[model samples]
Target: MSDDEILMHEIDTQLPVADFSHSSPCSAANRVFVTLSGPNFRINNGFETDDMEKLYSGLSEKRSETKQNEFPLIYLIAPAETTFDQIRSAIRTAAKAGFADIFLVTKRTPASGNYLKHGLLLRLPTASGLSPPSIEPIFVRSDRDGSIFINTGPSQEALDHCREKRSLPKLNETLDNYAACARAGGFEPIAQIHIDSSATYQRAIDVMNAMQRCHIRHITFTDVTSTPHRTCQGMGKGKPGTPTQSPSAIPRPPQIVNPVKR
Candidate 1:
């Protein structure tokens, strides 16, 4: 079989299963596939290694050959056993190498057809791209037990604030409170989610859904090491003075899945 055929075969066998709950299909053109197998990162199911520098180099070369203004879309295939930190690092490296668009590849269900042939794509923000000065980024972290914490800095006080808010089960309400506070201060809120190494993909999905429900779509996935130290914006500050509407009362974000190629 040809190289393309071989790569497709590898993706079919190794991609993870995720329920994006979107009906739109992803296109098959102008895209590159990267997979994480155990401890190694594989490019197009070919060059495989644990060294991130090599992976960055490979992605940079691919970036150089793409269209002048259009970077090739990246399809990342990581199994359930892979850590969110691993996935975050891969995405950060890809962005640093000049590839802007990236997606997490997964099947709609376990019994679904070959992922490459029939699967849903979850588009991830390329990196912490520049935002308006009027917008401030709020840091978020999710624990394995479905507890989520949010703060504006990486200091111990911020950490403690997150821990305090862990007992709160209403994620959507907590996030909405933050967004309202930021808006009240004339600053738009952007969320930079920090996914722990032990956190599962399902937890990440839950967090994403919560962000969507709160109308916070300008989200970025950040690695633990790159967290910034800013002034602590207390997590408890967003508690609404009056009763807030439920998440179901909000309109959903528009689905923008690319057209499928025949």
Candidate 2:
């Protein structure tokens, strides 16, 4: 079997990636891209945590009626090997399903793994000349046993640029040194595995659904109070109070602070 077929069989037993697009025109738009990684021991297995803190950022902004059309684009970052074939398969599947974007970050392989040529799977579009709705691949470099550092967000452009300048021996040496340092002191093996793609994807979907519901509520409230006058008891009377709720009912700030400020 092909690598794609092998990965498909290894991960899911029920359906193919192509089957995901059949649900709705917006199904792909609601899909979340998740990256899986762990200690070398658990690298190929699943995660064991349900940490949703990173995934819930910016939810409120997109939860309003005016922005209901927008959905959350989730990118999971982990220190694993992101193969080119897997990246291509995901992009093709997501593109067909109408997703806005797909993203993943994995560890850079050593000279082995035949990843030099196949590594293009992780490369993102620096220009429109390549493809639409670009998929980002982040490659983290680690020493033989170092904990990996993953970059999955806006820095994709910088990494791609750096990768292009591979001829620089100085740059290559710096990365190697850093990886070695990380392996010596920073590497933390996972005691227990937790969160994985399916869990993260479900949380994303839930967040999107909640966002849509919140948007609907906002619209309903706006429409209820937008009227200047209401016909009540056979008399045209102006409503004094629109009966609106405070946006701060939950007492939340615009952003979260780490609290343990020095």
Candidate 3:
């Protein structure tokens, strides 16, 4: 059988259960199917292990075998219980292994209660591309409670914006304003999103969609360790260490930082 058919067969037998109720049907010719099994990840149902070093090594060898400049799309089949943090780590690992594009698989229904006939695809942010040197990337963090923090570095104006609107519905506006500001400063609008470990996959997707709507297409995922601070806080007024402003006032455009240098 051809490679695609072989892949479909593997997917049918090994892909983990995921909620595809809100996803739309889609297909791609160049793709690899992966199943997230707890601490270990399975690639195309042929390899399974919890050792990240081994996983990266294997993937790198496979990548080297492919034609130059060709990166396969990763279709990750994750169980419904998979947390956003796990998904993000998987994607990061794939990126390190020389893969770029990734898709989260979803299915409308299970056929015969045994296998999935087809899957709905959610195109994740490309795992490879880096923001251009000329553009300063803004950082966005999603809290466990689904609140968004937009940091543009020490900007009170940005902090005020976040304080006023931190919900997903207002995410578009928040990103748009940042994009506009970046453009005004002669830089491309790129956002680096960091998802909390407790956040949901749906929340990550929502943030991604919001970034796209604001024309901030150059996106990347960042780990918590990379950021200067985990959570954004307001410079409180009055008594020492007292935050006169509401906790919501903490979201703001952080000072522009060069991601390439970080």
Candidate 4:
């Protein structure tokens, strides 16, 4: 059986991940998982998650919509490749679904595109490009409302980034660190987990179980791969390409605060 097969099969196998359902906010709400394809989409294909599982572009959205409302809104978008069409579809699905919050697990920053006009744009801080999530970010974001409610999970590319960087922290350690950050901030902060994709199902299971243990009931899953050219870096809402200030210019700013724009 393939890794994706194992994942779906394991979903029904009473794994440690499943047992944590009572602990999860979403599970308690009892939302059925659904996947779909529609004319609105660009490529009309699913994802690597599906492809790896040999279930490409095929999704089961069987649950009744009436039953779905009882649970909090969460959508996992795993685009098949890093193509603009796939990226656009993922964004459109989330928006059209009208999900209150979304958990996007993509290698590319969704914010780097205009896809996220619904909520606040928070660019998480990292130690290395692949370091475990930083507390500095959430603590800063916590002051805002709708505080920590995980609506998404990370994708293979995210985990791959961690692996390439060679700083994959222990699953428990990463969770503990996040828990501490959330507690200290006195608010639940939104964030994604970068589990090692090489670890495959085990890594995913560990992350899920960890979330349960931590009472993080909400999350999403997606991998945005725009397998094409960059038409716009975040569709005009792109983050700072270069630092706003040089060391020499930093001391002089009270209002200007580094007027440089790249």
Q: Judged by TM-score, which candidate is best?
A: 1
> Which residue segments of model 1 deviate by more than 4 Å?
1-28, 106-132, 135-137, 144-146, 152-169, 180-187, 220-262
* Tens-place lDDT digits, model 1, residues 1-262: 1111111111111111111223323235557788877799888868888777889898878777776454366777766445566765676566556554556654345565576653234443212222233455666777654457776355412222233231234566767888899888987556766567677554565566566555565554543442121111110111212111111111223453342321
**TM value for model 3:** 0.56
lDDT of 1 at 138: 63
Model 3, 178-239: lDDT tens per residue?
A: 89999899876766666777776555656665665565655445444531221111111223
Best candidate (score: lDDT): 1
Candidate 1 minimal-lDDT segment of 10 residues: 229-238
Model 4, 135-250: lDDT tens per residue?
32211110011122222234211122242221223433545677677878785433333222223322233344445445543222222222211111111111222111111111
- lDDT of each model, Cα atoms only? 0.50, 0.24, 0.48, 0.27
Worst ten-residue run, lDDT, model 3? 8-17
- RMSD to true structure for each model, in Å: 13.9, 23.5, 15.9, 18.9
Write out the backbone clash pairs for model 1.
none
- How do the residues 133-177 of candidate 2 rate in per-residue lDDT, one tens digit apiece? 111111332211222222324642221122222232332343445
